[model samples]
Target: MAESATALAIMGMALVTYLTRVGGLFLAGRLPTGRRWRAALTAMPGVILVSLVAPLVLGAGVAEAMGAMVVLALARRVALPVVVVAGIVVVAVGRAWLTG
Candidate 1:
């Protein structure tokens, strides 16, 4: 694609992202602030994370499975940053060991 077309595509994506964020904020402001809603909102991140990771875990090879196991084991004990780094390292090392 031409430079102008690429720039336009990027701008379009940015606009869409910004609009979605604004729409979410607008919707959130209108939502009920009840206890059930609060609880659901609190759990939303974990639910979303599982939804995203479930597919990868189900389809993964040994290396990815092992990495996911490590992450799960450390999730409650360690901070998120630690868990993330450990997961990445585990997957990288496992892949190397398996394929080497």
Candidate 2:
């Protein structure tokens, strides 16, 4: 594609993303803050995370699988940064061990 086309595409994507976020916030503010709604909203992040990660995990190699497992274990008991670091370390080590 031409440079101008690429730039236009990027701008379009950014606009779409910005609009989606703004629309979500706007709708959320208008939604009922009942217990069920609040619980669902609170769980939305985890649901989204799993939806994103599930495909990668299912298609992953042993090293990636090990890393995902490490992340899962740490996720329940530790902060996100720690879980991320541990997952990276586990994947790297597992890959090295497998290759060596």
Candidate 3:
């Protein structure tokens, strides 16, 4: 059935994603190819995060993009919970203001 196929596809995608992240960790831990290789591995997580988020942020309107900027600015200085709250507040207020 279509529903069963969709579920299988979702599971396949999830399995592949999990394997890729785990494979990166395994390689990073098990291999010492060189400094450049290690550095690339070290940057993998950030690169993955940006890849996942950039599309959503770029496709969204000003409010969402501004919220993402606020998140980035606050992410380093503040705690995760605080940053999340700030982003939510900014996006909500921005949307309201823009819509008015």
Candidate 4:
């Protein structure tokens, strides 16, 4: 019964996520295409990314800080996937070494 309840919760969350993304696409299609609007939309992803990462870098342990630096240094030189994997590795190693 607990497992079934957990599965239902997961499915409900998945549906909400999918609907939110699709709703954004529909809304975006109707949104203004003016110069400023376009620029703001273009910059939104980076803004969201920085908002998410800033808290971790500011408040988290050394491992997260090191991971953020690794992400920054490799951001321009490597593919995004590689940079993400590298950051994960650095954080994992940093935590194990620093905490253990």
Indicate which candidate wins on lDDT: 4
Candidate of highest TM-score? 1
TM-scores, each model vs. reference: 0.66, 0.62, 0.57, 0.62
lDDT of 4 by residue, 1-100 (tens): 8999999999999999999989987888899899999999999999999899799886898999999999999999999999999999999999999988
For residues 61-88, what per-residue lDDT tens digits would candidate 2 score against the true structure? 8999989888888888998998999999
Please list the C-alpha lDDT of all candidates, in the order they appear: 0.92, 0.90, 0.91, 0.94
- Flag regions of model 2 displaced more than 4 Å: 1-3, 32-39, 74-83, 96-100
Residue 79 of model 3: what lDDT?
A: 93
Which residue pairs of candidate 2 clash? Answer: none
What order do candidates take by lDDT, descending? Answer: 4, 1, 3, 2
Model 3 lDDT per residue over 16-92, tens place: 99999799667656776799987887798899998999987878889999999999999999899999999999999
Q: Which scores greater on TM-score, model 1 or model 2?
A: 1
Clashes of each: 0, 0, 0, 0
Error of 1 at 38 (Å): 7.0
Question: Which pairs of residues collide in candidate 1?
Answer: none
Worst 10 residues of 3 by lDDT: 24-33
Per residue, candidate 1 scores C-alpha lDDT tens digits across 1-48 of 699999999999999999998997778878899999999988988999
